[model samples]
Structure formats: structure tokens, C-alpha cells
Target: MRACFSLDTKTEAIPLVPLTPDTLASWLEAHPPRVRAWVEANGFKGKPNSLCTLPDEHGRIQGVLVGLDTEAPVWSVAGAARKLCPGTYRLDTDQDVAWLTQACIGWGLGAYRFDRYKSAEKPAPVLQLPEAVDADEVLQVVDATALVRDLVNTPAQDMMPEHLAEAARMLADAHGAVFSTVEGEALLSENFPCIHAVGRASSHAPRKVELNWGEDHHPRITLVGKGVCFDSGGLDIKPSNGMRQMKKDMGGAAHVLGLAKMIMAARLPVRLRVLIGAVENAISGDAFRPGDVLTSRKGLSIEIENTDAEGRLVLCDLLTEACEGEHKPDLLVDYATLTGAARVAVGTEIAATFTEDAPLYGELEEAATRLGDPVWRLPLHKPYRSSLESSVADIANCSSAPYGGAISAALFLQEFVDPQVPWVHFDVMAFNNRGRPGRPKGGEAMGLRAMFEVIRARFGG
Candidate 1:
């Protein structure tokens, strides 16, 4: 909800020069001897995200040099924003509107810091809005991204189910959208049995929060988020290290809320429905245990093979509800920090995306490539569904197989989704283990921009 950029019409803003390995030598050769000498002395070889400051005859800052990979991510300029001295800077190179937009976004993102709890914090270096960039669009992406980061960065103590619902309520209020919730025992009356079951043990009551906006005649877009506020792994329980960052277990909910904010802020033509099953998988006398049979809103009984696989249970009932009613959504997208197997398969930075729609997947791939958000496609292998087969229940919440955990998880959710509808599942690592140029070491929004692009293209603003 805070501004990410400051527009400056002044011509005296400091220049930021982006240089690739090939271009660095030539650019340095063109500069003054002292400037070139200082850069070489500092070991500035134009490596991606590397920076060097040029000084004038009076040792005053003249300009900044940012090293870039020829195929560097759009956020390459982020390092300069983060490391540079506080000053108003502008991109000095020639680039298209898209490139400028991405650069601005990178700068804005790098400027982010979660100082909500800190007593004192330094301000980020300022970036002047580029001339050709669409200010509104850039700000929308940055604000939504910041929202995701802020929500995910907050510890579970302050980010419980009630807090998550309050955040959704604020978003709905801001957009003049319809907001509703089925909390606690009401979840049972509403037939959200899986949601109720998974969340019943937590002192903070679990609920399904929904926000609806846009015209009724417009294309419908439904976004489902697995909002497991904290996962102590239920009665089965998680080890100490495993439970440490469980606060981010609700990354999926943060993602959808962030995406919803973007769509509504952009005033896209599509009617949007955002549903979050806010819950905490806490250990207690009432916590649902392994082997417990839970019936979903769709009447499918799920045998809980592992209480840690609680995200899918929260999502199943929400997805079932989304597919119902007069008009089905033209597109349904769900985000979850569902499986560590996905992180093992593609590492932490890349989101493991699963969708049956080839054409939609193609569009998403292109958008990811162009936008510099990375998402790797994994099969929703139907054969893996056998891994989830249970003799007593309609399905098992987890696979018996050790491998293909991500696939099995996708397949499990696929049961609740209608094949005719376009559905995408993003099993993302919402936390960055290490800091990168624009992405910090805390909560990161994976695949958000790429998914936003797909939605934007499908139903134009």
C-alpha cells in the first residue's frame, strides 16, 4: 500500500549505466582515465549485479556503473539500488518500455526492507521513475510484491488466521468488493470439512475468506491459496529445524492476496474471486492425526497419510467450492508452499508449475521468460495418482512412493479440479534461502509476475 517510486521531472538526476561484459571495456575506455582506473582498481569486470562508482576530479560522485549479464535477469539493476549511496538516479541507456518497466520494478523491489519491528532503519537509495515506463503499472506490481513480502515476512504470532482474514477484509474494503467468511464451526455448516478439520486444533479459529470484485458479465478468475498459518506438522509433529520457518507455511495465501491486489488495482476486466483457507496445523489433543479420514466439501474422503500434507487438504475444499455456482471461472490459479520435493527438483528460486492445459502452460512459460520470473513445469502425472490410492478412503492425502512427491501432490489437488477448466498449481518456495540482487533472504513472491502477465493477457485491463 506504500509508494515504491518517486517521479522526478528534473534533468539533473544521477545516471545509472548498465554494462554487460562485452560492453564494459568499451564503456570504460570512453570514460576519463581516472574513472577507468578507479573501476579497474576496484576489480569491476562487469559481472552480473556488480557495481562501481565513478568519481569526478573533485572526488564527487559523477555516475554509477552496473554490471549485467547479456542474458541477465531484469532485476540486475537491483544491486545498484540496494548498494548505492542515497540519491535520485535514472537509467541512462536506451531501452524499450518493457525493459524500463522491469528495471524500475527491480529498483523498487531492491529498495524493500521489512522494518516493521525494527526500532531504526536506513532508507533505500532513491530511483527516479524512468521516462517511458508506465508509472501505474510498475507501481502496481511493486506494491503487490511488497505486500506479499510483508505478509510472508511477518512471524506467525502476528500473522494468524484472524490477521490474514483482516488483511483480506482490508483489500476488499479498498476495492469496494464483496467480502465474506465462514469461520470455526461455520465451516462445517458451509461444507468446508477439510478446511475445518485441518484448522480446528489451533486456538486461532480457521476460516475461508473470500473476496469478489468486478462486473458480473466479465470473465471470472478464481484464485485459491493454501493458508496454513503455521505448520507444527499437526499431531505427527515436525522436528525443530523443520518447524522454525513454518510461519511461512501460509505463503500461498500471501501470494493470492498479493495477486488479487494487483488485479483489482489494475482494474482488469475479469471478475476476480480470491479464496484463502486460513488455518494453522498446530499440535494439540484435537489436532487431526495421521490415518484420520476427513471428508471434503466435494464428498471425497481423504486419508491423512501425513499431517504435514495439510496444505492440499485446505485447498481441496476451496477448489471444490470455486468450481461450483452459476458460472465457473475461466481461469483458476492456486499457489502453495506445498512440497519440499519441488525445491529439491528445481531449487528454491524456481516455482514448480503444474497444469493440464498445454496452451496455457506455453503462455505462462513465455510470460515467465519475458518477465524474468522463473517457473519450471512439472507433470501432473496421472500415473502418480496411484501413489495416493487408499483402500479405505476415496484418496490418500499423500503418496506411498518416496519419489515424485511434487507430482503426487499436484495429482492430489487435480482430483478436486474440473478438467475442462484451466487450472494452474504453483508449488513455490516462498522464502529465499540466500539474498540475491532484488530478492532478499526472507519471503519472496515466486511466479507472481509471470502469473499476472498470463491473467492480464487473457482478460485485458
Candidate 2:
């Protein structure tokens, strides 16, 4: 269901049925005889999000009576609007007029139906916003969120490494950014050994796309996304069920690209550089196997304990390259659907963040709370460095022990990062298993908004 705020739109006033012990007394003073009778008969003791559709003598639907708890969060209105009949609805009171915009977004999010494979039974309800709310901001947020959802929902066949490069290219074209890509054997020649190793098995050649924009002198912000188009778990193959949703393995890249689009479109003043190490971890004769030793762009030799843990390998090279050029960004942030350990630590709802800089984490944490996009900061414990220690290579890509796998994974990435520079690594669960207000149950953007807010705050627009 979609909501639009316009006086021109057809809408009916919805009185919030108050929660009181004396329902009859509350009804007698506030509502008409018909409404009072209905409230008494139906036992409509006002409860949060409770709704009662008022009817006429002829039993036809007249209007809606909804209940609210004033103390609750604004998001409590989520999914409640969809329960009402499909039509334009307006608030009966003027005091909370500002809530109209937030409610509109909530209702719009509540009505999202990813009915790509099936049809929705009920039509979406429309909510009208009051004139005070900013319509343009609402539309912009919806557009960017829809972009994220659409990219995440698309299957791997349609969103492979090359296809992801096309997406990056399209965004570059839109903003007049300079776009360049390194593909196939060029990766080997260009020192992207890890990227080439992970993607060489796929029929479609993997590509690392780089897009740069804004004035060179501005505070630089580099975004690195792990774009594993489809992860088949390589030589260490996953079971059928485990590989079912591998299409969303590139959720991180999709989010970075989507956020970049929003930032560029909004004209945020940072010198932005977007790097996507797009690849497919597929199995073939040339697939890098378990126990294989590979050298990264940073010259760190990695022993592949499990080929499934290849996302970090791709990111390591891209990050190394991001730091190589003369115009290196002051801040580097990388997003990835990196490890199952992240989901285990914080679950699918929250993104796991790791950074050595406390101020960066504090700012990010505060921004996340403000934006309502939650992210939990995981530690980069120095002692966990032993978990990834390798007897043969410089380090093992996967840890020897399973405990603190998420921290070890972050520590693994820490090996490649410039210790002097500020960096935040996000292990994001890009998919939503259960639908929530403003979040649909499909491929979703987890930390995009929080990161954007932090970026904008650090380097003002």
C-alpha cells in the first residue's frame, strides 16, 4: 500500500480510539450514537494499533477507528495502515501533524509486496500526508530504498559480476564520474591475484569496477564493496540449501552502489571514490581449492583453509588498490556479506562493524541510532590475531578455531588495512528474513543510511 499526502486526495478522518477503562464513558462523550453503540457491542477497549471499521445502519463500511499508545515509538504505526481498507485515510487530529510524513513512509513500507512470483490478494491502502511534511524527501528516500530492494531481489543470473559492473557504469554515466574496470587476465597483470583466483572459474569473466567523482582537493571518501555475484562455495561446495540464496551474496556491493547514487544525486561535497571487487566464486577445473596459497595486492600471502571464505580475498586486493594511488582517500569504508559468523553474532537485523578508531565508531553508532538503521560495533581484538595464524602462509584466510569467527574475520581484513588511516568494515546481512516497517522481507540495505549520515556529517554537503 502506498500513501500520499495531499488535500486533493480522497480521505476520511480516522479518530484514534483512546485506551480507557471506561470505554462506554469515553465513547458517549466523543463519538456519535451509532459509533458509541458499535464500540460498546464490539468491546473495542482501545489498544495500540487496534482498529474497528465503523458501519452504517445498512451495514456498509463507514470509517475506521484506530487505537494508539502515545508513548510508543513512531514506528509502532508500521504495518497497521495495511490492515485498514484500501482508501485514502487522514488523521482526525491536527496536533501530531508532523507524524504524517513518518507515518506515510511507514505505511508505504508496510504495503511493500515483493509479489514477483505471486500476486497480492488485497490492494494497498493510501495515506494522505498533511501539507507541512516534506514530500520531496519522502520520495527521495523511497526511490533510493526501492533501488536497493530491486538490486537485492534480482537473481544472480541477471546480476553477475559483469552485470554489477554495468550497474556501476550506469551510475557513473548518470553522475559524469570517470569509470574504469579491470577484467580477466588483466587482474593478474594488475596484481589483483586474489580477485582473479576467486573468479577465474566462472564462464563470465569477473571485473573490478572503479568510479570516481567530485573535486580532487575535497576530503576523500573511498567506498569498497565485496561484489561476489554468486558464491557457489568454490571447491569447498555448499549444500543445495546453503547455496539457494547465494544470489544475494553481492548485497554489500548493491548497497554501496545504491548509497553512492543517493550521495551523488544529493551532491554531497566529499571527493568520492567507489570500488567494487565484483567476482563469482564458482567451481571449475581452474577453481582455487582449499590449501591453495595466494598472494594479495598488499603482498600478504593467504592460505585458503576453506574456499568458501573468499569474499575477504576479493576485498583485500581492492582495498590495497584503493590506497595505492596518489589521491588516496582520507577515510575508507568497505561493506561485505563477508562471514556467517556475523549473522551468528548480531543476527540478520543488525550489521557488524569493526574499526580501530573510536571516534569513527562513536559517530557511526550515534548516526545509526538517529537514522533508525541499527549497526553493532564488533571488536578488532588484538589477541584474536592468533586465530588466523598460518603455519605455512603469512595468514590463513579462514581461522583454525571456530570461536570468535566474526572477530577473526575482521582481524583478517585488518592485516591489509593501513593502520594509520581510519577505516570501518561492515559485515552486513543484506537480506531481511521478516518484513518490518520501511524494510521488506527480501534483499535489503542494512547499513547504507547510517554510513551515509556519518559520511555527510564528517564532510558536510
Candidate 3:
């Protein structure tokens, strides 16, 4: 099933019903005796994500009942979508609009498949838009998420700096936006020295892309993403297993591109600018070595403590250019698969956010909870800022301290951000290690929905 919907695209689909522990009794009462008997015989008692297929007198599927865990409806919906037989279906539900919307989105998400390299993918269950659900809204989120998954799941060979730039350009063109990129030696001439330094080792030179959309009069929103296409850890090389998933290091770029797609599709009343620094952190004779000092576009000198921590190197220049450059934003947000420390703190499933703006963080957190997309806000912890201090440069790319690595990393990036600009940073484990009902074990769009929710609420189209 494609993850897209429109009001005109109606379906003569089968029924997929949802039941919760609290409402199962009433639901059973309204159904026919045969249906109730079938449900009872199968021990369908509305347990979380449990299912039963009700048959008619002729022994054909009359309807399918799925149990719901109200607190996390996405899981329940995903369970149904994944387990159901391949057929066209529509929600036969009486839940409120909020619950139904979640169901539609979950159904779409569950049906997702990243079979780009395969000759053919398995047929998936198809879903019709549930009543009272906004098809456009659901499509916006699902399409954006699919883009993230596709980009991040691809290997580094096909998704290098230029390839990432092409993806951005396509997205920009599709949305009627202006797209531009500064690549290779131009990165150095453009004063994006730190970006140049990290990506210069590889044949595919580092590049930065900028996309602008919406009218000038609207609220200005700037998004910066760290696009390290592949990280070989430079001279501070990672162990074997550690180097395996480095292809997903550019997940932050995938995230921002997906987020930007949502913004433009929703036509939110905001002037949006997306800045992504795409580079490959490969090791060679010319790799940027540890202890080297590099100057960012903001002109702040940074000491490279460890080349493995290269996400921030690319981002510092982008963040500086986003915050202080022309077309400055009213609100600035950045995404990077920056630290293992964040994954340690929140686990791989839930993404972590760092922002000095407490209220902004609170708003995004609340929206995330409501949408079943888990997110957390870690501290910009000023006390830990001292750990990044350097004797030779203004700051170090990483800290020597063993603990609080996530906080210190955030502190490092904060050096380039304009404090006055409302800034938020996301540190995500963009790849999912475990396969859940809807969320497969590949690239995931962490916190993308929650951030979109806040932006939409603040600046409606």
C-alpha cells in the first residue's frame, strides 16, 4: 500500500475494527451472536494488539477486530495492519478524530517497505482513509517518513554528498522552492572551512545545500542538518562493528529533508530555509587529523579532539550560517546523529532534544507524546560546557570526560548557534535495530512528526 491519501481516492474496502479493554464489552453487545461466539471461541478479550477474524455463516471474513492499547495506539494499529491478510480495508471504528488519525497514520507506516534493492517486494495490505481523517495530513507525515527511510537505508556508495544534494534538489523542485549548493573547493572559498576540512579526504568532496521556500513576510524558520554521508572515523577510527552502520551517519540530513517536505506540503505560513552540510568522513593521507584546529564560518576556532565526533564539525558551520547569515531565522532547529551518549540516555527508540529554550522544548515534547512519537529534552547543561574548553582554540569538538557525553556534545554545538535565536537540536539514532509492527529495523524518522506538529500549530497556512 502506498503511503498517500486524497479525499477523492475512496475505496470499497473491508472493515478493520478496533477495540479497547474499556469498550470491548459494549462493542461485543452490538455485534451479532455468531460474531460474538466466534470472538469468544477465539479468546479475543481486547488484549493489547490481539486480533480475531470474525466469519459469516458461509465461513468468509465478515470483519476483523483488533485490540488497542490506548496509551500507545500506534502499536495497536500497526499490529492490525501488519497481521491482517492482504486486502483493501478501511477502519470500522467509532473512536474520536485524534484516535482515528493515529490509526490511519499507523496503518500507512506499517505498510511501508524498503525494497529498493529487491526485484519485487511482498504485497502489503491496503487501507482506505478512515472517516473524519484528513488524507492530506496523513499523507504528509507518511511520505516524509518514507523519504527518510529510503535515504538512510541506502548504502554510502549510492548516497554520497552529491547524491544527497540531488535528493534535496528534487525535493525542493517538487515543492516549488529554490535549491543551491556549494561544493568541493567552493566550500573553502565560501568560508565554510570546517565543513571543507572534514570532507576533504574523500574523492566525493563535501558540499552544503540550501533550500528556500514560502513568502518573505511569514515567520522565518531555519533548519540545519549534519550530512556526514559516511563516517570512517578519520584517524580516530572506530572498531569493526562500530564502523558498520556508519552509512546511516547522514540520518540527520535525511531527517531535515523529510521535515522540510512536510513543511512545504502542509503549506505552513512560514518562510522555511533548510541548510545541510553533506560530507564523507573518510580516512586517507589528507584526512583531518585529531588535535587539528579548524575555523567555522562563524570564525570560532575549534580543536578536533576526536575525528569520530565529526557530525558537529559539519554542523557548526551550517548552524553558524543558518543563525547569523543572511535570511536569519526566527526559530532555528538542527538534527544530527551526533552522539552515542544520547542513545545511551534515551535508548535507540526515543530521540533526545537539546535546547536552551525550555518552553519550546516543552511544546515539542507535549506534541510528541500526543502523537506516540517519543522524544526527550536533555540539558544544554552550562556546567558541562567547561569540559569542551580548549587552550589553543575557542572550543574542542569533543570532551575527554567519560560521562555526560551527550550534554557536552550539545554544549559544543551551542557555541555556533545565536543564543538570541530560538534554537533546538535533535540527537537521534536514525537506524532502528529491532523490527516492530510498524517500525522496521532500518532508518527511522525520530521526532520528525512532533517537530512538524509544533511548527504547524505555530504557523498555520
Which pairs of residues have clashing backbones in candidate 3? none
lDDT of 2 by residue, 338-446 (tens): 9889899999999999998899889988877755678999989999998788889999998868788889988898888877668999998889988755566898877
Q: Residues 308-374, candidate 1, lDDT per residue (tens digit)?
A: 9999999999999989977999999999999999999999999999998999999999999987899
What is the per-residue lDDT of model 3 for residues 328-416, given as tens digits with 9 covering 90 to 100?
78899889999999999999999899987888888998999988889998888899999998999999999998999999999888888
lDDT on C-alpha atoms for all candidate structures: 0.90, 0.79, 0.87
Q: Which candidate is the best by TM-score?
A: 1
| Candidate 2: segments with Cα more than 4 A from true spot | 1-29, 36-50, 55-74, 91-100, 115-123
Worst 10 residues of 2 by lDDT: 15-24
On lDDT, the leading prediction is 1
- Alpha carbon lDDT at 431, candidate 2: 91
Ranking by TM-score: 1, 3, 2
Runs in model 1 lying further than 4 Å from the true structure = 1-4
